[model samples]
Target: MNLFADIRALVISALDALAAEGALPDGLDTANVAVEPPRDPAHGDMATNAAMVLAKPAKAKPRDIAEALAPKLEADARIAAAEVAGPGFLNIRLASPVWQEVVARVLREGTAFGRSEMGQGQRVNVEYVSANPTGPLHVGHTRGAVFGDALASLLEYSGHEVTREYYINDGGAQVDVLARSVYNRYLEAHDLDVDWPEGTYPGDYLIAVGEALKDKVGDAYLDQPEDVWLADVRDFATDAMMDLIRADLALLGVEMDVFSSEKALYGTGKIEAAIAALDEKGLIYRGTLEPPKGKLPEDWEPREQTLFRSTDYGDDVDRPIKKSDGGWTYFAPDIAYHYDKTQRGFDQLIDVFGADHGGYVKRMKAAVAALTDGRVPLDIKLTQLVKLMQDGEQLKMSKRAGTFVTLADVVDLVGRDVTRFVMLTRKNDAPLDFDVSKALEQSKDNPVYYVQYAHARVQSVLRKAREQGIDVSEAALAGADLSGLTHPAEQALAAKLAEWPRLVEIAARTHEPHRVAFYLYELASGLHGLWNLGNTESALRFLQDDPAHSAAKIALPCAVSLVIAAGLGILGVAPAMEMR
Candidate 1:
């Protein structure tokens, strides 16, 4: 039901026919030809650049090629006219019934109307929200979590076999810090005074993990040394924090298919195996890095460490796998995790990290490049910081003040739906402002409200139509006399409906789910425009005096609601059936 693709295929076949007649040179590369909507609606319903692309290759003027191709295109009933533009552009005006047919097609397909097979069930792994198992997730991790979860949903809707995964960084210094923080809480549980240290987590959220540890093994490790209790407490505290993370994600309606532990990668020979695989490719070496690009640190000294020749794969310099103290660097476990992903035989990989990790992108990409030898492509998306505002003032999140915003705070303030939609309104690399006041406003200025209102308005029309005894089921609507839907407003609404399938393909191809959110807003705008037209023009109304005529006109807006529901579904935003 993709009119654009259908027309593009027609243009390609027409070019093949031209080659058969020797009208144009045989084998002029047509891969670059594009069929898209004309910039100006006056030009035509669709436009193609086939003639222009084949002109130089076929050794013929573009106008001559367009003129020759016009007659060939006119033979199809769907194309009303194929006029040659300034040079070689072929401007096509589709018959009114062509777009009218799209409305009926949408009604028949319902939410499945714009679904695409572009992914074709190829396995894809998307790793996001790899936040360390510390306290509750903060604002920054929320953006990445929403973005990655929505992307996984979008890919699955478009037919990709997607795995939603989170990499728990528990095997790091941070988790030990969490353990010590819990240790302090454990001492606090024993009614003893403890001073909060500088490097330990000072958040109140860890107090519960401490209390729970006291409940599990009450006062047994109260006076024990760090070595005697560090491992047991670290394991217990990390598990509790992960449980908290899972609950926080559930608050925002997110569920990961897998939770990969960095601890599992350690002591399993998995890191060794992954590093050895890279070593087989000559990517590993024992070397010392030159001082960083500008000034060298005062403590900088040349020291031999286990390094990876990342520069060979386009990194700025070689990377250290093991620190000078004979322990793995932070990147060692990361590389091993990605290697695990590659060995799982996924067709592609996508990592969603915070934008602060921008410097690490080149090295990680180089690691994947060398590990898989470019067999699997890795797409890393960095989510920028999300700023919080309220009442014309910056909302300070000082952990010491116990005033930091948690994911639960945001979700509880407005809602999970508003939180998810607002986070997705901007690109992953662009900063997002989540205003508590503006997000809750019930006006068009808020996209979450605007798009949801559109779906609700359409539902109102359908409910009214059904209450009046008009059959508005999809089966009945599919058979409506759609040709009666010829009003300018009706046709404009139909045009928006045609863009859904194309939008799905574009969003999936680029791994950008935010585009779906943007498209939903535009679609809602078009719908609201048509709904408003009913105020001044009687014909623009969804339900007219004539039941059959009203059915035809009603189909357009109902289709609009259907596509909005689909888009909202991908974004994990619930579509409203009535404005609250």
Candidate 2:
């Protein structure tokens, strides 16, 4: 149960009672009223800003409103005290039984304790890691992949029907470059001397693909012209690279529900349909854009091109949808792709992009807004770069990837669980420095280890209880007499446990999975704190002299493990049952 939500409801009920008695203004809007934990724990268990926010609207002094509301709240069986703090902020202290009930509820609910229905089953499409199918996914794409996958999982945990998607950039010139590069490698396979060109991919990863192409074709394209082999080799190389990418994603536990192809949009009338729909709204025009803001390039010209009036939807300027040569511009297919998504009837959309795409955000938003006629909302989250370091030095590039470290390299070095958890230790928009040595270290500085250790420690306590002939099952602990868990440390951890549901709703609402990671670290810290206390305070230990007392004491840490497992599950991490 969300204790904060319950208390906020109680405050609303009290405010309604005041309005009923004419002690406050009639029809006072209480939407902004909030009940949350006090910033300083010494203040109280919870605090509300009902009086402060409603003062001007209700035409009453905040202190008078708080003073009138205090008695009504205190009269409830849950509230121990409702004290009026500075500036009419009402601080509330719940009875000890409230925290006790939280522990029992956690035990009863298990890992489902924090699951929420806030999304109301709305369909959401989360598109991420749409790297070009030309080579292995690099570290930058890894950050986006992890962030997007975690976000999709977070949405699902909140009851959204989420589809994790990858948009293949196969329709671009890059794929053609990939074809030529593979052809060069193919000639090398046939014992031909090939000079490496500047724009061709020279990575060794394509060597196997080239050899495979030779095995299949067997001299069919030998000494052929560009037209005869370009299309066939492009298709073959794209498929092979995609296979490599799929394997790389598997290394990090990432899977896509849909892999949409950009090439499918070409020669299929999808791009035309998307642009025509926008044109029907008077957004398309033949116009020349203003020269970009700095020194104009020597080849710059005011050529009339097919443009979308993106400024109408808040973009800085109109955007080109087609070139003067009558070929579709890069943005045309993207608009079509999102239009395709909207047609699939998703209520909302989220695109996870690398930080380098920051410039493309407003234009894409404007396109979705125009395409949906402002019906659907699109959120673009740009994940910042990840700096992989080891022993105080930046790690070198991967030989296979040629220029950058592949996602597979990182996963192979640190493992899927550590790679995923460490990627989200910072906000999606913040730069993350993932130190390999630190990630593997069993120390508090390592967030993933610290969180896992908390879960493992609880499992150890439960195992000890089991050895002492105590029934440590969830049903038994849930039915235990938890009244004895009144120590300051125990109470504090229970309070933290009470915050899980609230935290889930907040993180899901903000589309930030980093909040879940941060909360897990704090909750783990709380459990660790209580575990340390048991060393000096014998009565606080889980395995006590009396079975009943032991059951009551062990229930708190048991609930802690349950919640940790739940949080880790959202992050796609398997909680460790024991540490080495």
Candidate 3:
């Protein structure tokens, strides 16, 4: 149960009642009315701006309106007091039983306590980690992978039908380079001397793919010309690199529901169909783009070409769909891919891209807007760079990846849970400094450790209670009388638990999964704070002389652990059963 929502509904009902009693005018819009935790907890449990928002529309003073509404709200059993704070804000303190019931509700719902139905089952397609299938995924892709996967989970928890997808960049010259790199490795596998060429991959990871190719076709393509082997090797090498990427993602607990191929869009009418759809709306034209701002390039020329009127949809300029040579431009396939997504009947689309692709955001949004006629909303999230540090210095590049650290290397060093949690410690558009030493630390400085320790502490308490012959099963704890949980510390922690469902909806609506990580850390801090309080106060301890009393006290931590586990699940991190 969302106490904030329930309280907001109560505030609306009070305003309606005031209207009926002639204390306020009728038909005041309450859409902007909100009930949230007070800025200062000392003010009240919840605060509302209903009086302030309705004052102008109701043709009444805010304080006058708040004064009239307070009595109507206090008449309800759940509301202990409603006081006008400042000039118009209404601060509400709920009855003590209300906070106690929040704990019991958490136990009954288990990890499902904060799950919301806000999306109403709308279909959402989340495309992320669409890195070129050239080699194993690197650190940049790792951030996008973690962010996208967590976002998909968050949407699912908030009742959106989500599809995790990866768009393979195989239709470009990059795959040809991959094929040639593998061919060099294939020659080395035969114990032959081969000169490394410019613009080809030199990663040691390709050594295995080269050896595997030899095993599959023994001497079949040996010493062959480019035409004879390029096509076959391109297909083979692309498949091998994709397998490596999949394994890398698995190391971090990410699995995609679909892997779309850029090459698949070619040799088909998909690109033409997508362009035709835009053309039908008069968004496609033959035009020459103006020279880019600043010093013009040596090869800059105003050439008439097939272009999409992206400016119509807020892009900086009209984008060319075809190059001067008559081949499809790089943006053509991307437009086609997004058009296919719109055709799939998804109500919404989300793309997780690396920070370097920030310029591509507007054009992609324009394409989807033109394709769907603004019917499907598209959100593009750019994950910024991750600076991997150890020993106060940046980590060296991976030998396997040749130029950057691979995702597997990070996961192998600090572990999957640590890698996933730490990646989300910062906002997606903000740069993150991931220190390996800090991530592995067992102190409060490490957010992942701190959060996990809270869950493990709850488990420890439950185990101690069970050993003492106090029944602490889900049903028993849920049914326990929580009336004695009146300590200020206990009430504060319960209030934090009541914010879970509301936080879920806010994070999901904003498409920000990092908020979940932040909330989990706050909740963990509250749990740990209360746990520390029990050391001095005999009444605060979970284990008391009376078994029934112990049961009642243990119920709060049980509820805390349940919420922590639920938050961790959305982040794709497994909750710690015990801290090592």
Instruction: Score every model by TM-score.
Output: 0.97, 0.99, 0.99
Per-residue error (Å), model 1, residue 468: 0.5
lDDT per residue for candidate 3 within 1-580, as digits (tens), equals 8999999999999999988988888888899999999989999999999989998888889999999889999999999999998989999998889999999999999999999999999999999999999999998899999999999999999999999999999999999999999999999999999888888999999999999999998788887899999999999999999999999999999999999999999989999999999999999999888888884677587789999999999999999999989999999989999999988989999999999999999999999988887999999999999999998999869977899999999998899999999999999999999999999999999999999999999999999998998999988988988899998889989999999999999999999999999999999999888878888888999889999999999999999999999999999999999999
Location of the lowest summed lDDT over 10 successive residues in candidate 2: 294-303
What is the per-residue lDDT of model 2 for residues 1-580, given as tens digits with 9 covering 90 to 100? 7889999999999999998998888888888999998999999899999999999998889999999999999999999999999989999998999999999999999999988898999999999999999999998899899889999999998989999999999999999999999999898899999988898899999999999999999888888999999999999999999999999999888889999999999999999999999999999998888888884678577788889999999999999999778999999999999999999999999999999899899999999999998999999999998899999999869989888899989998999999999999999999989999999999999999999999999999889889989999999998999999888889999999999999999999999999999999999999999889889999888889999999999999999999999888888888999998
Evaluate model 2: give its lDDT. Answer: 0.93
Every model's Cα RMSD, please? 1.6, 1.0, 1.0
Task: Give per-residue lDDT, candidate 3, residue 309.
Answer: 98
Please list the residue runs of candidate 3 whose C-alpha ends up more than 4 Å from where it truly belongs after superposition: 297-299
Q: Which ten residues in a row have the lowest lDDT in candidate 3?
A: 294-303
Candidate lDDT scores, in order, read 0.89, 0.93, 0.94
**TM-score (C-alpha, index-matched) for candidate 2:** 0.99
Alpha carbon lDDT at 299, candidate 2: 55
